[model samples]
Target chain A: MTPQRPTMNDVARTAGVSLKTVSRVVNGETTVAPDLVAKVRAAVESLDYHPHLGASMLRRNDRRTRTIGVLLDDVSHPFSAALHRAVEDQARARGIHVLTGSLDQDPVREQALATAFAERQTDGLILAPTGGDLGHLEAHTGMPVVFVDRIPAGVTGDSVVSTNVSGAAGAVRHLVAQGHRRIGYLGGRRLLSTARERHRGYLRALGSHPGPAVHDLHDPTAAERAAIAMLRAPDPPTALFTTQSMVTTGAVRALRRLGRERSVALIGFDDFPLADLLDPPVTVVAQDPSRMGRTAATALFERIDGYDGPPREIRIPTTLIPRGSGEL
Target chain B: MTPQRPTMNDVARTAGVSLKTVSRVVNGETTVAPDLVAKVRAAVESLDYHPHLGASMLRRNDRRTRTIGVLLDDVSHPFSAALHRAVEDQARARGIHVLTGSLDQDPVREQALATAFAERQTDGLILAPTGGDLGHLEAHTGMPVVFVDRIPAGVTGDSVVSTNVSGAAGAVRHLVAQGHRRIGYLGGRRLLSTARERHRGYLRALGSHPGPAVHDLHDPTAAERAAIAMLRAPDPPTALFTTQSMVTTGAVRALRRLGRERSVALIGFDDFPLADLLDPPVTVVAQDPSRMGRTAATALFERIDGYDGPPREIRIPTTLIPRGSGEL
Candidate 1:
């Protein structure tokens, strides 16, 4: 059995003082008499009592619950996890707790979670919005929203995103400069704006060369299968461009399995752990999700403090690190 | 200005129906006629109306919010992220939302968070408690609590953890079997029970060799520095026993920096992404954080549904994968 902890009442009884006096002492009020304070402190020490600051803060009518909600693509995904941590770091510093959820690209789920935050006393919302129309988000207008990673059409809010279009275009140009014309494109679901923009960049760079073998799929397994099939084809591309980090990993695995690690050139969008450790070390266009998260969170807090200014769209620059894979 | 979303009033006006009729239609009342239903549906589609499922359920006092809160050491850490995903998966299946926080090993923060969850209408809490004295949790004893990853010293609750002691011992024994007598132990913060238990295991496994060099560190930088010093020592250990994934990563970095990866053996406690991709694939005693999270959540839901039984201590087994790094 867990030893029962002494409550304020217990401390009061032990110290021959009122419960209010014990609470005052525990909360560090200096109004109490020295002798009474000493007794209360001794009782508190004996009982190992801790005054619950968060609990009492929530009880006040005007005091903030000091909690925010974050809805991302999926908390388990590496990108989402990194972004979540960045937001958390910013929030944690301000004594604000984060309540997070995975949107799963479902508009219905997004609506439910957002409106639910309205009831949960969450101060604000940060969303990497999915689905076509986030118009209904206006229903929860009183609550501020900060869009990260992906910005939805039909809903305007403060957003922080990466330079997906130019980043992808730059990667394609790098590949072209290496004298490789045939390049397959592995992309994420077209519903995501990042995927669409990356695909557009590929098209823009592809002035010729059969428009590059394109496979737009969601998740790594599907991307891996597509890569395998494309590589096995009669006239497979000598190089490939994977849009997302997950897709990049899948493409890497597929190429390695086919014994073409050095033969096929690849430049992936998004960086992942161990990318530098992979055989030939995967080259990628690295987007700063952490910075995006931090910037979006700062903007959200500004809005939460009643910033009625126009919503701003912040695009972070991307970096291309060439190790070995893209060199081929 | 952001476009205001159409509310029930707007929908009613568009459909030329009463607010009650619109409400009835949105609530899916069977009394509505087919023609009226069609009209309401068209209005709903045009306005993009999404029923607030989370809010409505919360309005009912007796209904469970179906939201479980998880307090981890850090949500961004790969172990925590993986565990969080597992919990979210379990909660999502039952139409539950997960509210998570990172405690960062502060007792005050932990208590504040735990008590705040009490007020936030969380149905259950899954805590990887960092606090040594959690007696104050008695203030909110009504809620169900499941300790995951780390068990609190003073609080009694259900917990699901990996076999840290035996796992570390097994790895140490493996290193010994490989004919390595001198070994160095690189651990996480000693305050963490996992780190302490792992160190104890290391000591237990060091039956003969004058107790291997032990360095208890928190961050990767400290771990890397400690590893460098230990490796450069006059009588350096032939192998290393890293307690956590981050520590393992730091040790790997140090070993690689010194060009001693192939020469010095390492058996890390926790397995992380890209461990297999490292120059010399890292061998590790892999704890199933996902399984721990799933089990902990399952227990939490069981408690939420009135499992008044005694607290449970679930210890999931760990796996040791023999990769290239541990073989030396």
Candidate 2:
């Protein structure tokens, strides 16, 4: 038969110390005396006590796992990657570990990942929801959750996001200042809060500046297809604002295919790799994903530390970078 | 007292089935009869037999954990992130989950992360070692390990990396062809295997063609600091070769500060966001991080599946894209 696993009580008894001492040592609290620490360590080693991290965390009076789950649409995305690193850095200083999952922008996958993390009893969750109803999360888990980037409808949580509306409006304003009216909006899924807000910003910005024809082709599922169709229209817009990095790439590809790359001005939201290297360097409204990540992680950690004030929303600013494409 | 957790035997008994049938249902193996599967499901729910994932894994004859630990220097780096996502995608399809930790390029942290993951009994480890000694890893665990990016010295394991030497040489050749005789090299930590390889390539490419004044300022702790020092150098080279993306940013900042932004030529290894948007679009050798990640993950999964064959080193090719900077 396999050996029975030693518990915290065993370690405390072996060390001739109180249960609280063993808890303090296990938790890495520095208040314990050095001699007592050595005794506990010796006893732990002798007992061969391998603490069940999850169980110990759940039973602890403090109720901190010192672990957080980060669910992203795709971990490999440049934006997501930057944010993840920043969050990890911040979490590490507080002695926390990160459990990450890629949802692949699927609602079912998102739900599964969230449920798995919750089952593992992660202290908190930082998620980039796949724009689907996450009602089950609110109903099932009482864990503190902070939404990042795209926010799902009917789900209430603390959120850290870029100023999508203002950023999109700024891009349109820049295009208008360059004497271009008749602008087209290339976006991802309309269901995405970010995409919808950007589209709204485009309309509002266009209304402020007269003579711009605003067309919203909010089909992120097939951005390239939508971009090609928009460009092939009888009268194409002179300027285009592509929301999301993938949409930017598709719009650029469509422009290259039509051989009108330089004829139309373009500005993309969320910068991507090789954007600036294209024929006319692509301009973009760059969101600091790392900053956004740091903010979200900070908020989650604060909540974990007994800050039960209220749900807060933090928006990191985006910068409009002008290149040949945006300048036309 | 806490409720006693139910075991597989109890579940089978309650469901009026054999232990093997219960195991089949839990594993999602399709051999079980439909009626029996329903019965097992009902029993599982009724008894709240939350199958200990690790325990169920061990009970199986194969004893596969179906989980891997990914230890990268910084998971937020675009290259690292891309690779991580690919690995997770592949792992998820196989019912495997990835547990990730960032080492922040610290050897001590890397050791701590490795210990933590091993304690959790991860089936395999995918590491980007901090160029620190990996003797502890070899000594402690018998789990399958795959090294990504920088391979540590004296440690032999399956590794996946980009062709840094040839890629760097190709970049230098491109600059040399563009009439750049004087070139400066900005690199990261020289101890890193990739950094050393890239430096070697830089020397080999410059050796035959009008020996460029090479300044091997390897391993600038921060990009901004490196950028300032490189730009302020007396008799700075006419062209620059940045070995890493962070180094590339430093070079760009330095060039802009010196007002040589439009005049100097640059070719960086590893592309970054908005590389082209600067006054003159920067050229680079782009490595497909996603492919590297997928390949590494595939190799790890294969190893986990009892492929105890000889260890191998796999190198993915990098491509050079010429833009305004290289052309200059």
Q: In model 2, what is the error at residue A196, expressed in angstroms?
A: 1.3
Q: Which stretches of candidate 2 lie over 4 Å from their true place?
A: A1-65, A173-180, A208-236, A249-265, A271-286, A302-328, B1-65, B173-183, B206-239, B249-266, B272-283, B306-311, B321-328
Any runs in candidate 1 off by more than 4 Å, and if so which?
A1-66, A93-95, A140-142, A209-211, A309-311, B1-65, B139-142
TM-score of chain A of each: 0.84, 0.85
C-alpha RMSD values across all candidates:
6.1, 5.5
Extract clashing residue pairs from model 1. none
lDDT of 2 by residue, A1-328 (tens): 6344567888999999998899899889999999999999999877766665545543556656576899987787778888888888888888887889987678999888887776555789999998877987755666789999976679778899999999999999899899888888877677678888888878788995533332334334366677777777887788888888877877777777688888988999988765654668789999999899999999999887768777787889999988779998
Docking class of 2: acceptable
Candidate 1 versus truth, CA RMSD in Å, comes to 6.1
Report the Cα lDDT for candidate 2.
Answer: 0.80
**Error in Å for residue B314 of model 1:** 1.4
- lDDT of the structure predicted as candidate 1: 0.83
Measured against the native two-chain assembly using Cα atoms, what DockQ does each of the candidate structures obtain, in the order listed?
A: 0.27, 0.30
lDDT of 2 by residue, B49-83 (tens): 65555444434556555668999877877778888
Model 1, C-alpha of A295: deviation from truth (Å): 2.1
